[model samples]
Target: MFRHTKATDLLNSGVPIHVGMRYMGHKSANMFMHYAQTLSKTHEAEFLRYRKITTDGREYQQDPHEMYEAIALSKRTDRVLPHGYCTLPPRQTCDKGNACLTCTKFVTDESFEPVLRQQMEATDGLIAERQEAHEARFGEPMSQENIWLKGRFQEKNALSKILHTISAVRTSDGTFTPLRGAGSPQGRQEEN
Candidate 1:
């Protein structure tokens, strides 16, 4: 809910789409490309729920900004969250810009897979439900965004596996063991 509220508020407040993308934890604004689609779909859904359109409906043309207004008007009266903090490091200062692949935040290690998987599943479900409407409005399937998100998630997952293996092979005392050498310090030398 915090994410939705922040995203909705950002859209309504005229915050640049890129700023909202970062606030919503998107790796790239492209993954969050359907901001207008999201607003439009939610607005149309709510509008349809509250008012019935006639069978003799004529051509309907809405102002491009109508969806943005609807989002603001539908704002919940309650706070999005009771408490929260921004723990993520400032990325604006970094020069990576999603190309260098040097930022640790984007990398997955074993510790973050469960969280990543859960997030991926939730995102997939949300995108799936809005699929048809998004395509109709945007002339592109919402899954295109999902595909990019999933690719990033998978890249993180693969990096995590590699890191996990590297860590596992290290000794308790912090020394890395040689993979092909015989076992023990001297290897069958005089039964030492």
Candidate 2:
């Protein structure tokens, strides 16, 4: 039940940086440190409880995939593969490599699957554009100003498209989730 915000709050209140890094799956302390300033001092007491759990190195806090696997295991059905992690059905004849588009299996359980497909299409295009831009600008070390300009344009474009995606996927249940965090589908499929 721990929300991402709660995990972040726990990380900034004097919790060992390494433990926070572990919890967040951040490859480096620097990644976690960037968000450290966002933590609230008022939540120190809550963080103390987190510290107590990690005081002994005996227990391993499960990784994100492990948590997903545990949930999947509990929900397994006769049709579901072992661990309830079903493989994608064969891709449609479309060359976009969209396994989800042709996959009937995913439609049964995941309500957000369509949102994921749409977002992936958007992201794949964006990534190709970035690669082209980078290649066009190659052979010269990008000046900070040039880099910032490109990054700013890309960021604004991504944010606008993501907002559109959220609007498209806001269901009758009023639950809308983004496909991935701040990156393209190729980089973030593991998060699902």
Candidate 3:
């Protein structure tokens, strides 16, 4: 247990895997990887340390306790979704990858709007470049790759629209307040 914890801690602390393996006297990467696996709770704690949230036009590290409370509340209220938390059972599988923008299980709050918009812009740029290349290669009709890009762009556009519509209410004193109630559909038009 000590060795495993030490290995995981070292890796999580940004130590190179090869260095860790050397320190641990491991002969192969397989054994080193086994020791490097972090417990879920430990991983969550590490993730929270680096999590940043923008509030009141300033960025701040999220309070882990508050984040835990929010997650717990969201779970109890069935507000957890794919991108965030969702009502899905723990054992259920939703085979989505990092394509959260196209997942029907995705949920986003006002805090995530800026990131969503950024993603939309990036996707649009990629689609434009890919479309240009496709047109040069196959002039008359859209190629399969171009068609796929259009579909993904549409999905991202829809998500961006939904995020644009959900703004956090601001008080007279300039404090941002989250919307009341559990998570809303925000955007869930596609599945993984």
- Scored by TM-score, the top model is 3
TM-score of 3: 0.44
Candidate 2 wrong stretches, greater than 4 Å: 1-72, 75-98, 108-118, 121-192
Local accuracy of candidate 2 as per-residue lDDT tens digits, 1-192: 354565567564556678888877778989876655443332322212221111111222334243334334334332233211233222323232333222222211123336444555666677667666776889554454666446544544533443443456455776443232233343377778
Tens-digit lDDT track for model 3 on 1-192? 999899988877656568989999998888898889765555454434322322112223344455555556424544443334332344566575555545554444454555666766777787778778877887854565556866776666666555444432434774344222112122232221
Model with the higher TM-score, candidate 1 or 2? 1
Model 1, span 87-139: residue lDDT tens: 12333343544321223323222233345355546555765667767788989
Q: Against the hidden reference, what TM-scores do the models get?
A: 0.24, 0.19, 0.44
lDDT of 2 at 177: 36
Error of model 3, residue 41, in angstroms: 16
Residue 5 Cα positional deviation in candidate 1, in Å, after optimal superposition: 43
Number of backbone clashes in candidate 2: 0
Worst 10 residues of 1 by lDDT: 79-88
Residue pairs in collision within model 1 = none
Local distance difference test, each candidate: 0.43, 0.42, 0.55
Give the C-alpha lDDT of model 3. Answer: 0.55
